[model samples]
Target: MITLKNVTLRRSAKVLLDNASVTLNPGEKVGLVGRNGAGKSSLFALLNGTLHEDGGDYYIPAQWRMGQVAQEMPETDQSATDFVVEGDTTLVAAQAEVRAAEATDDFERMAHAYMELHDAGAHDAPARAQALILGLGFKTTELTNPVNSFSGGWRMRLQLARALMCPSDLLLLDEPTNHLDLDALVWLEAWLKRYEGTLVVISHDREFLDAVTNVTLHIDAGKLVRYGGNYSKFEDMRAEQMELQQAAFGKQQDKIAHLQKFIDRFKAKASKAKQAQSRVKALERMEKIAPMLADADFSFEFKEPANLPNPMLSMSGASFGYPPPEDAPAGTPPTVIVQHVNRSVLAGQRIGILGANGQGKSTLVKTVARALAPIGGELTEGKGLNIGYFAQQELDVLRPLDTPLEHMIRLVRETAARGQNHGQGTREQDLRSFLGMFNFGGDMVKQAVGSMSGGEKARLVLCMIVWQRPNLLLLDEPTNHLDLATREALSMALNEFEGTVMLVSHDRALLRAVCDEFWLVTRGGVEPFDGDLDDYQRYLLDEAKRQRESLKESLKEPVAATTKIAESEAPKGATGTFSLKNAPAQRKLDAQRRQQHADKARPIKRELEGCERRMAELTQEKARIEAQLATPLAPAAIAETGKRLKAVGDELHALEERWLELTEEIEHTAGA
Candidate 1:
């Protein structure tokens, strides 16, 4: 169990946790949630031992191993399989022991080391690692690709896989689904459900938390509050709590008013002075109940557009794709991802774009947004047709060095240049006021966009889009950076908006809340999907399994499962007998035995190497924490470091013990 007793924590001058306490039992899947900057990450840091309490005590069982995704981008040429395999430090250490024993030329030690290596899953490491990779939406062909060859988002997925590969008693995942599409997210939820450890995840996707978490930990106003259910249940319970708190506060206010009135009316009279004084004392002693104030959660509404265009856009045999790069030869043909797509977007239509990652979803959206042109088909826009587009990479359209105000001003200039101004004011003050409505008030309007958080930037993009008052909204993964409050706010705003909407998002809540229909982009074509989000999820899972199975089938051996080295139970030179006494032949017999041992051990050794890397990581962290303690530090900080050191040390010891036990069984089996 993990316990924080009356913990008071501060990040700089800000009090993140004030006398906060909570207990988390083992094997619980907890969702840690709060508004942005509500100390969720701070609590995570405290749990992982990077931050410390200024007051009170925090404790986690010393023997429990912990796993967390590394925030840094991985930079390595190692194959993806090797990279994930190395995450298991236990296997690495076992392999090291084998090499050392072989160097010493000790036969018994070699035998023991071989057994340990087998137990550490040396033979099937790549297979297990590839499974994790594929589960996270990687192709089987990419299993042996260099890690550094992937893009940033894919690299982050790899980071997640590496964390999942580590053997741990506790796993901490922060925004684990931000980079994932729907298919990958579903796979991850299934994986976490099967994990036999304590899981604490921070995610903005409401459905994800509900799927993976059995408990909810909410941090609000410097207090840690535990809820006995998942995210949706937490919302319902909190709403009820707020309702009750408000009623209590109203009653308290009425009582206080009555007490004050009696005191004021009777204090001047001689006979009633004593009674009035008692009432005054009663008022003074009364414990006040504070009113439940809405926590200034981010909320906004879309501005009603000046006009609505029926059949906002029409595509006839439209082909959505990318043009050749500038460096490509002149005759190179454009890549057509989606072709022969006849679709119509009418006013007030809400559409959800459904497809696997890289299956032309984004290409279709890019064409609709005018970022790409149709290859060999007609795409026509109705008069007064206006689109407010949110690209998946917000940075692609956002100028990082520019401030929010500057971005708005640029929008205005471009809008005017196109002679498409709708009656809205383009004045600087009006723009500033509009930005303020999106929570970019005062100096925040001038803050460089590059320095803002992802959520903030996303809000800015939404603000600019609202200012345009477009008759059509094209949003691609708009909720990627938004927290729950803002995501809900967007959902509400979209529901109320009268514009035509085409959305591509992994957020199921948003899709369910706003989309009236779904358009699937698959096999280079587009068509209406007559199914709900649940059906789409099932389709994704089935497709993923089928693709993976196909890849596995391609790599399977033609030989029978029970194929072995001999036609009969006899020696190579002798008939119906086996002997090992031949001096030169003894070595061959021993070698054969070792190979047989390893081949038979494959089932027992499957998937152990990935955890061996975790042991190495802990060893390094233990050393770093030890060195940190050696330096002069604040007493509280030193205490925190000491706690972390003990945790790492005990975790390493536990891993070593488990490794020995696994090797022990394998050794006996191999010897027999």
Candidate 2:
């Protein structure tokens, strides 16, 4: 158990936590969430003993061993496996004991030391380390590569592998998924779900938190709050708390009402109903969790484009990749990551790009963004196709020495030079005001882009994108540095934008909220992915299994196929059905069967949606009645309103129960 009693924590003169008391039990997987700079990292420091409490007591069980990813990048020339194996302090201590025992010529001590080494799994340390490394997205061939040969992101992955290699009763991970792609992120989630220790993590990813965390801890205004469930549950709880605070909740009420009006007026007139549904759904969610999200420091939107291109882009027999080295022989070929990509980008389409790392997700985006040319074949763009490209690396698009004001001014000048009238202000004062809309006010507009945080840089990129009013947006990992509030704001803004979007991101919450369809770039081609994110995750896991098995086959000597099945491949459940988790053929059943299940789920889903809409209506009516009751009213009117409130509550409860039942039925049908 870890306990903080009346703990006061401070960094310099700023108090992060004051008189905060909390208890963290063993074997709890907890997600710690807060706004950026609200002391989430400081709290991690407190737990790791890097910083002590300024007052009161903080205690952990003396026998508990803690494991955490190293913050500093490794500059060593050691092989990746060896470096990770060194992270196991227990094994290192045991080996050291054996050396000491041999030096002293003590037979008893030497035997004890050898036994300790064996118990620590010293003989299989390399294998264990390699598994961790590969699961974090390293190639098997690269296991023995010198650690210094990798880039900063890959090096940070090695550091995470090292942390996972260590045996401990408690593990702390901070933004572990920031460097990971979807493939590696899925693997890490599975690994953490099986972890036997108490796990605490800090992340802005809502889907990641929902998948891996059972408990949530929140830091708000120097107070530590603990919730009984995951991030979604915490949001629900917090929404309820805000609703109870009438003075605060009143401020955002009119804005929500205006949103409801917009939804009602525009849902029927929606040009693309499939795409516009995202907005209606998003607005419904916002109404439920209002005011809290309304508190974000940064909120802005993309201006509607001056013109819309029906077919924004078209590519035929295209090969997207980097050109050959200039020093290479004249006949040398270019590097083509994705070939034969025959696709068209349609106006109003919101597409999510899905693939493993190094599978050309970014390469395709770069090609479309005009950062690279097709190795072969043709790409055609529609007339008036204004492009706004946001690269994965902010530095790629930003001049380190330039200020925000300078960047905007240059954009204004470029637009003017091109003879365009996209409604951007031409004057210096106007550009400064535009920058202020993105939180770059006063001196911030003059601050060097190099001196800002990653989030600030991302905001600047978004600000630039909005200024151009592009009809087509090519964004790669755009939310990498944005906080939760900012992410929500972005999601809402995307829903409201009247333009085409092509996004590549590991943030599932953003993907699910924004994309109506998905494109999968895999192997050497691109195709439409005929599934949702949950289906894609299962596919990724199956793909990883196939990779692992292929690697195993390559390593072993030729032998009979009579080898025993691996434990993970064994039969599952009391029914003795063979493991379908890694069996692609078994899991890929006939379309007829899938359609039958979908048929069964359809009516239940319709019922559920009906109930949900009715519940929303009842909830809003209840709030309205409550607001009326809070004011001066005639006795008869008050009694009538109170009676209607009770009626609405009763119906809401009944419908809610039915909604739960329908949800369970549909899930069972799908699983069947």
Candidate 3:
């Protein structure tokens, strides 16, 4: 258990935490959330003791052990598995000493070392390390792989696994799900839910927070508020609070305005002058309730540029892959990643490109946006088709010397140079309003792009794109660093946006909420599933069931068919005696057929194994959804669940398709 007692944190004269008090009890899962630069991560640092508060009382049980997962991996010479195993350093060192003593055959040293190691539970270290490694998705063989060989993402997982393995009184995680795939994320969520230790995590993952956390710690406007229940329940309560605040602020403003009017009209009369002066004083003293953070009058409308009828972009027979060049040597062959992608991007259709991380979803978007040339396809452009493309790595393109405002001005000037300065004032106001929406205010707008956080830079880049108002918005991974509130606002805005939009995102909830249809990029091709996320999910469940049945049937096929063939091929010999020499040709044919059947069975067996894994994964997803549904449903939570279900369904359908193909092949081969 850890506690923050009226903690006050300040940096460069800005208050990060002002008299903020919070508590983390045993088994408490708290999600820290706020807008960008709202000190969410800073609070975690303060609690973890890496960053001390200016004035505060941070308390934890004296005997409690603490673990914090660093955003970046720490420098070490050990392999990935070794690093994770080293989490229990004391035990590891003792165990090593014991091993050395045993190797040297020093009876006295070995006896002392063995007792010390056993007392420290060093003997169980290897098993614990193995369990953690597997739980974090590392194969047993990968245990000895060099840590440096892994990517930053995998290193993060390693850090997470290491932390989880070392049992602590409390665990502090900052954006733990940032690098996790759905499977790992689900595993983590389940782990945290069942973990007995206290947990304080700073995450923007709504579904994650909703599933694991019992309380929400919200830091907004230099204030920390704790709400009972998960993220969704907290949001609902906050919405209610906002409504009340808005009403009270409105009434107070009206009262003050009326008082001002009365004072202005009756000030000339000596009798009323004293009363008017008092009323003015009262009005001045009245702390006019601050208005809720909502759209200001200066906020400009984001209207898509006008275009001719029909879709802005269309693709026929569009194929994409990272195949080797035709000029390559004769021994090499190219891989076809996606083929026969026939899709039409209509004027108002919102499409979502869904697939695994490396499945060319982004490539498809780039091809449609003309950022990349398609491998082989017929892509047609509609009249007046203007596209605003937002790449996942777009922030890297920002000029380091330029401030956020300067970036906007540069974009505006480009539009002017192109003779398209239709609404400069509207654009400028819109730019500022958009910046504010992303938590970048006056001073922040003036800050150099290089000085801003990754999230800030990303938000600024997105805001600039929206200012151009292109009819077709091609966004890849748009919600990467955005907070929950900002993501929701953007999702809602895009939903209301009157334009053709195609986005490649791993954020399932955002896709389901904002897009009208979904496309899956796979090894064979870009397949369009005809439905919303919910429909896709139902299809997954059905497909999963079908695959299980098919796998069962496949396993039974070889034995049953072989037995029947043996019975039918029973030798009939003259004099009621079977002669092996005479039936040699038939026997050879049967032997060849059996070999063929065996060959076919091998691939089918492999396919069946894959199908089983897929089914298991889907079942886990259904369990997650059922868990979430059992809890309260906020709009965001509902959207999150819907998207997860859709993903599960998509995966199931893919497995089922593979199962059918394999089963058909098996049947054909067995018949011969």
Candidate 4:
């Protein structure tokens, strides 16, 4: 746990946090939210000791280790694994020294080194590392891949994974979900839900905070206000408070007006003069109500696309996978990533894809978009079908030097030159209008693409997509960087889009509220389901509960139900008779409740503890594995070790599943 006492931070002439006091406890998720340029990130740095404060004091426990995931990373020419492992460079150096001592056959030194290494569990670090990598959406194949090969978005994810894996009592995440696709986000949400340490994250993603955080901290007017509950709960409470404040202010204003009128009419009168002066003093002392800042009421209407034929895209005995290039021939077949896949996309359908990361979800999208031709199988585009693809890294498509207006104008000219537009001038006007709808007006429209945030770039990409109005839109993680308000706006536009949409998103609330059908991209293959996201989630829950029940039934033990019945149920000071005749019945009821609780409660508590234990174990294992693999080992030795490592990994995964099940059951029983 960590506490901030009388923490005041300021810039040249502006106050950021003024005498701010907050206490963060273990297992509590806190959201730090404010408007743009409101110093959310600055506050994070202050907490992490990366920024110096100008006034007051920032207090952190001396024994506590704090970790932070900043918005930016240092430019390093190293592999992603190398960058991540460097999070604890002192440990890495110690490992190297220990290894050297062993190699030199210095028995005494080796023995000492061995103790240190064993205590650190440097041998098991690799497994822990792999778990973190997989949980953060990295495939085994990409573990050794150079960090620079990935886009900035992916690089951000790698940085975040490092932060999550690092040992910390307090974790500060700044826009942690900015680069994650839906799958990674979901995994992160689940992980953070069971996270035992304290966390304060700055995010624009409401669903992320709502799913993970218990408290909302609003930074306004250089002060921090804490609200109990999630984002939605906070909003409701704030609204009620605002209404009361407004009413109070209205009453005060009326009194002030009446006093002014009395002063105007009777100021010279001796008795009236004294009374008017008292009213003036009271009015001056009264503080005005601060109006709540609300998002502008902005709605976007999509340009409806014309109807197209059925079977917009279809795959028969098809495979969705990427093949690695062989060493031998130029014309040889690519490696098969996803095989035996059969699916079809039809017009007037909005489909949501759900899957774990590294499950070929992106591959499927690519195949359908014709960005990559399928290695095997036939994929056909229906007649009259026009497709627009929104890749997860769509920002890469933007010319960094090009201004927003330039890109819009250039795109329009190209489209017009192809003879598809009403006119060049008209197209430009439409582009400008579309940009305006997205809150990019005048000077903002002229800002270079390189200067925009990920969310802004995504919004701009969407504007272009809507401008084109393609019959079929393939969107990959479109809402990754968008804030709650922008996300809602995009969702509304997509709902009214008059076109076939296939999207991959991890925000369950958004998916549940927006999607009409499901396309689950599993490790095995893509399976289509006939319901919305909420229904699919419900189905998953039901399946999990059924599995739990089946396991419980197999145990065949007579576990008494736990239900508490209180003795002396009458009022505390009641004059009526309080009978002791039903004591046996009450005792039996109490015993049954205790037994029932033990039956369910022990397992849940044990499982939760097991999860925490496993997480720590995995962390240690990963650190060890990374250190071992860092040395000059033979290829065969490495391969064999990797296989053993994979087994440990599989066990870790099973443990994670069990943890999720147990925690969910506990929540359900508590709710009940």
- Using TM-score as the measure, which candidate wins? 2
Instruction: Kindly list the per-residue Cα lDDT of model 1 for residues 1-672, writing each as its tens digit.
Output: 999999999988999999999999999999999889889998899989999889999999998888999999999999888899888777788778866875874555655565465557654566677789988989755776899999999999999998988889999999999999998899999999999999999999988999999999999889999999998778767756765766555654654454344334433431333222333332232212112212334667777888887789989988888899999998999988889988898888878899988889988888888898789799989888889999999897899999999999999999999987767777889888889889999999999999999999999999989888888999999999998878867865786677888999999878876676789989899888877787788888788678656433322321111122222332455554556447476556656765676676555444234346778898688668757756877655654554455456557756654553454444444444
Per the 3 Å backbone cut-off, how many clashing residue pairs does candidate 3 have? Answer: 1
- TM-score-better candidate, 1 vs 2: 2
TM-score of 2: 0.80
Going through the candidates in the order shown, the clash numbers are 11, 0, 1, 19
lDDT of 4 at 444: 90
* Selected candidate, larger TM-score, 3 vs 4: 3
Clashes of 4: 19
Q: Which of the two, 1 or 2, has more lDDT?
A: 2
Model 2 spans > 4 angstroms off: 258-284, 549-672
Q: How close to the true structure is residue 468 of candidate 1, measured as C-alpha lDDT?
A: 87
Whole-model Cα lDDT of every candidate shown, in order? 0.78, 0.82, 0.67, 0.66
Which stretches of model 3 miss by more than 4 angstroms?
73-80, 87-145, 221-223, 246-301, 323-335, 409-422, 425-447, 530-672
The 10 consecutive residues of candidate 4 with the worst lDDT sum are 285-294
Summarize candidate 4's per-residue lDDT along 278-370 as a digit string, tens digits: 333322322121112122134465676665769888889898666666575777767676778878788877777876556777788877887
Model 3 lDDT tens row, 280-395: 33223221211222321122234657564486767899776555777998867555567787877787776777654456777777777777677787889997777777777655
Error of 4 at 266 (Å): 62
Candidate 1 vs candidate 3, lDDT winner: 1
